[model samples]
Target: MKALKPRRFGWWYVAEWRLRGMRSYRWTILLMTLGNPVLYLAAMGIGLGALVRVDVAGVSYLHFVAPALLVSTTVAEGFNEASWPVMSGFRWQKFYLGMSATPLAPVQLAMGESVAVSLRLWVQSFTFWLIGLAFGAFDGLVSILIVPIAVGAAMATHAVVMAYVATIDNDVVMTFMYRMIMMPMFLFAGTFYPLETMPVFLQWIGWISPMWHGSQLARVVAIGLPEPGWLIACHVGFLAVWTIGGLLWARRTFTKRVVV
Candidate 1:
């Protein structure tokens, strides 16, 4: 318990300012955040579903695609939070420097920022799920059980972030990060189509993408799909592995930069 509490505090410590603002703003973002999923439902699910004319995982294209959308958006949002926001805190904002002036270690700040960012991503998933509810797009209340799954997506994003920090020097790479990496993952991660239906060579990407794992789990939970117990375990296990592994790498990068 002693070890666990400080780790929890490390993440919480990163988001103190944002949390304070949220408490005061008490800002409800459910509607605003719903915009992307709604557009997704319209453009991809309904738009593309119109032409696909095939069932995936025994559900209509929209129903099958919706839950994955819930998880991917959360994963992407986590990467966004970890990247520019953390960079800004360190570079332009110098907020971490000020926090460093306090007793809060830089490592805690980094972890806290990741966790804070994860919280934002979690909200994105929750809002998307609520929207899924209104449209009758989800199959079961077990859908709510996927919050932790969405958090796993956040960890996956953070992994991308730790790997990203090693390469950063200019603003140009950010464009590459999104265009080359994030975009491809979005399209091919079995979000709109089943992994089995894709070309065999391309299927490898989905196998490695954290977004894909989280997305698949969300779909199973939300729709009450009759997946085998072990398959679900694989999805959840990959995400958990990424989350823990990413935190370790991120700690190393943060310590390397901030401590010495």
Candidate 2:
């Protein structure tokens, strides 16, 4: 076989390494990917939905909340993927330092890690959509769009968290992030209720949250939620900006940290 050229396809090699490592915990990932949607949809869509007799956002409560749940779950998983894994590569396992010793550049490593996480997000989001279909939470075939919308939001979230994680040396910040940042976004970012229903001061959380943006787009496609064209454009633009900007930031940080 020809000598493998790391320089020409270093990112793919890095991604392959990370993906193979995931097999160690394949059973755990499989359980969560399949189990989470089933439990949440059952409890929220059927159990709690029974009491929510009135329409929310012009649809049954289950229909309105389903897309939000889908986006939120994927975003949460993205955060998990970006956080400890990046830390482990840098501090615990020191795999990033090892990769740096080879021909692989730090940017390549970042891109590879991101690609793997995005693939996981895609799988998780699609599974959630399928479960939602069985729950009768979707409006029609258009609801399938939620899968990609969820993946985009999750990737944007993953990039942002990864950029931050690349700079930290310890887990203190990660703990703070989970409790202070992620939890607040989960509750206030239009996951369970419309942002307008919240206190005006608190509604800003949804405005800046990727989950809310993704949820808005998911709702639009999943149940035909009424939204203006310009607002829809804003959602797409925000996620695109976050994903692009965060990736650039992560690449820069990864180089600074690992290439030293």
Which stretches in model 1 have alpha-carbon errors above 4 Å?
Answer: 1-11, 20-32, 159-163
Give per-candidate clash totals. Answer: 0, 0
- 15 Cα displacement, candidate 2 (Å): 1.2
- Candidate lDDT scores, in order, read 0.73, 0.91
Off by over 4 Å in 2: 1-4
Candidate of highest TM-score: 2
When summed lDDT is taken over every stretch of 10 residues in candidate 1, the lowest stretch is 23-32
- Cα deviation in Å at residue 221, candidate 1? 1.6
Per-model TM-score versus the true fold? 0.86, 0.97
Query: Which 10 successive residues of model 2 have the least lDDT summed?
Result: 1-10
lDDT of 2 at 38: 91
Error of 1 at 172 (Å): 1.8
